[model samples]
Target: MVTTNKEKDLYKKLSIQVSLNGLSFCILNRKDNKICYFKKVDFEKQLDPIKVLSKIELLYEQEEQLNQPVDEVALLFNNALFSLVPENLFDEDNAASYLKFNTRILKTDFIAFDKIGQDTVNVYIPYANITNYFFDRYGEFEYRHSLSVLIESFLSLPKETDTPKVYLHVHKNYYELVIIENGKLVFANSFEYDTKEDFLYYLLFTAEQSKLDPEKFELILLGKINKNSEEYKMAWEYIKNISFMGPFHPFTFEETAKPKEELSEYLLIKSL
Candidate 1:
């Protein structure tokens, strides 16, 4: 990211994705539904989102024009409890127990689903006070767990061709491994890995547990990985049909003028 002392253009709508170790912001023109600017700031071994948010608030305060008349800011968390309970059998009050977490710590459990065509009710925990602070004047904003949105993404698109397909969304030092068979989620788990071996172990282990053959199955990788990266190379060595999923926006993803450094964050914003 370029260091700029200049004030930013006040976007009408914005999307922000915050994980344990990073933050990304995309400002948009509401009328055209086009991106104006994107900025990503990654933290090192820090987990407090509140500290990261304070820095964002400082920018808003310093640039008054960028703060006023902002219509909506959608905040999605990378870390959250993901649940896919059958609609009829789901209990709103007992959502925490399903994830084996205390209700007190994760106070706000929001139930969300695709309005048009969805079978299950996916519940996620979003921060209450920090989220509230974002829209103190307006009193409300859109929210989604990172994983929950991905489930909706699969639902809204063309069905997978393979019987057991894996989508590995790699983050800083961790990744979300999911097994989808014909648009049905069979397994969803996140694993923390510090090396290529660690990543491969969790991936193959998940596939083995899910009864998916490595050779027969398709593994589509998303987030932070590239052809030259060790993780990608190691994956290609072991997995047969491994492929990288990149930015599906303004320009179709092809090796272009510059390295698509922020494409992963762009994908998340596109998911919004």
Candidate 2:
């Protein structure tokens, strides 16, 4: 794990992000809306999550913040193990059977649920170690699909274009696409890709399948994508109006905090 910020001894609510190859933690002081503590550990390659999280728990074991009452922790899961079910037809009794169709259901998997948009509910797994750690410490907390936080926050923005707009939030090996039109959700899905060709193909294909002209539709890129990466170059070759997403309102980092741009929404969306 690489350390990025100086020590801040403030006690605050925790926000944790768990992914296939990494984990992040942020401490938020709600009274002043400040991000007092932040740390992100990116793995060189995929590691066993439970082992990684246990190591992480030890890394921060002495921090006073962990001792504080953290019943209000927010989780942003970064796996493909998530499904969006319509609220009207959502079956609590058959969640495992339903999600099995989209993603595999492991025996140790514990279902984490959250309400995303007005009509949809997200069923996802927060992985075993994450759930067990937070529950053991906080007793009760809230969880959300990492992608749902991005989409829900984006839809709250004022309408900007008459044409369809696609939001792509890229992570280590997956990306989320959300289409909006006239202030309503048009399409929302996640795609995983390994090569730049695969990434661009999914982006363009989704737009085309949605009947959105890649040349005309606007694309907002978020998460770990970089301007120097081939993913951006290939995407720019096909789509127009592609721009990086900005931070959520009312979130501030201390002069020394050095908040990460990639986790902007992940850090502040729960508060929003």
Candidate 3:
């Protein structure tokens, strides 16, 4: 646990998760892996590069201890962000060099998500799917993979011993749906979709191929969909027994220290 001058806190660590989709920053505690502060900065403003960096610095400046040498800095950026930079080519080397600290860019691995449960499908992006063209050269493939792995590892299953399970994952432009029966992967696939209807059609197609009773499998949806969101509504309309990517018992962690109303999406980093 890393304590700070603000008061003795439990953990001390910093991690930055940036996606081509958007930028997500988190100041975490290494002790319990609890996030102390987190915020997502959208690119809607089209700020200058210096301004972007300045915003990052300000974000870190908020923490008293964060001013010192940072132990690690992990970033996930879209590849295109660097394509236009002429001064410094923003490849993996440049991204690492730009961060300029003891940092490691995590590696993304395509692993079957279904290896964990029955009635559960395992999902993942196959390595063949990665393209240097679409994923900016400065992209963080490994970071995304690491985060997904962390979520999967952190979520526990006790009551789900005898049922089948499914694993789903979100990637650059595709979603993977997998089927697991009795702790083994049976069917797996990745498909691209442009609309919600497109996604639902694929889901129905995959479900038909699995040939299992829909009622036998618990539908686990991950990524970004709220209960009342259209995504969730569509999924539930199809499966009816849908559940979010649960992290077992997440409410136990009150480390964000914020009121429930102010909780950020970083909590979704864990599968729960």
Candidate 4:
């Protein structure tokens, strides 16, 4: 097929990040290098995949932007059902086995994997029903575990120091902890928490296990946290050098569609 100038001018991309707790999406106009639309919806409580799909369907029916055709679609599944394996040690045929010991999976669950950089493989379970719905609607689309996108985005950053740096991507009830040293990923994991104390415990524990001193290592915050958030306050009590992840993207945002926090939707925007 030959490409046309008109088609090229209409180039746009949609990237969505979905989890049991909520869903967020953004539409980017590639020609202008701008994000024209962005929205996030949080559920009152955690929902199953079926319920989440229904919410997504309703959003598409109600939101004019979501109904518009786009040149590309990328869906990211964010959940705790993931495990990272070294690239050399990963086996495609036994993907399930790699996650079995860490994540609970049934025989009927669908498994998927995303190779990150040259050294890591992220193995996880995506919502089959959600994937099928997207296929029926968009024909062909790209999908990956949210952690894969997160890790890739972080790795793309320039290495500033040899000392290990800790990154925390906070969600509603859970958060992802990632440590990097000399521009390479050293540790990554997710933890569920109900209170600020639980969050602090996990953060400190992970820092200890990584042999990083809380008072010395730099901690960068991303996602749903802020200076006033309880999670931030608890972390500040121990960690000395803590800062929120800065605006690392160059894309312009539509004034009306801009997110309140620059670091909000770090993964969704980067996935584009």
Which model scores highest in lDDT?
4
Q: How do all models score by TM-score?
A: 0.80, 0.86, 0.52, 0.95
**Predictions in order: lDDT:** 0.65, 0.73, 0.45, 0.88
lDDT of 2 by residue, 103-216 (tens): 878887788777776887788777777767766666666667776787788788888668777888777777888888888787888887989999999888888889898778
lDDT score at residue 175, model 4, on the 0-100 scale: 93
TM-score ranking, high to low: 4, 2, 1, 3
Where does model 4 exceed 4 Å of error? Answer: 1-9
Query: On residues 131-239, what C-alpha lDDT tens digit does candidate 3 reach at each position?
Result: 2321342232223333333323424444446566665554434465656566545555456666777777787778777875566677776654457656557777768
lDDT of 2: 0.73
Off by over 4 Å in 2: 1-11, 62-71, 260-272
Could you tell me the lDDT of residue 87 within candidate 4?
94
| TM-score of model 3 (CA atoms) | 0.52
* Candidate 2 similarity to native, TM-score: 0.86
For model 1, give the 10-residue run with minimal summed lDDT.
251-260
Pairs of residues at least 3 apart in sequence or in different chains that clash in candidate 4:
none
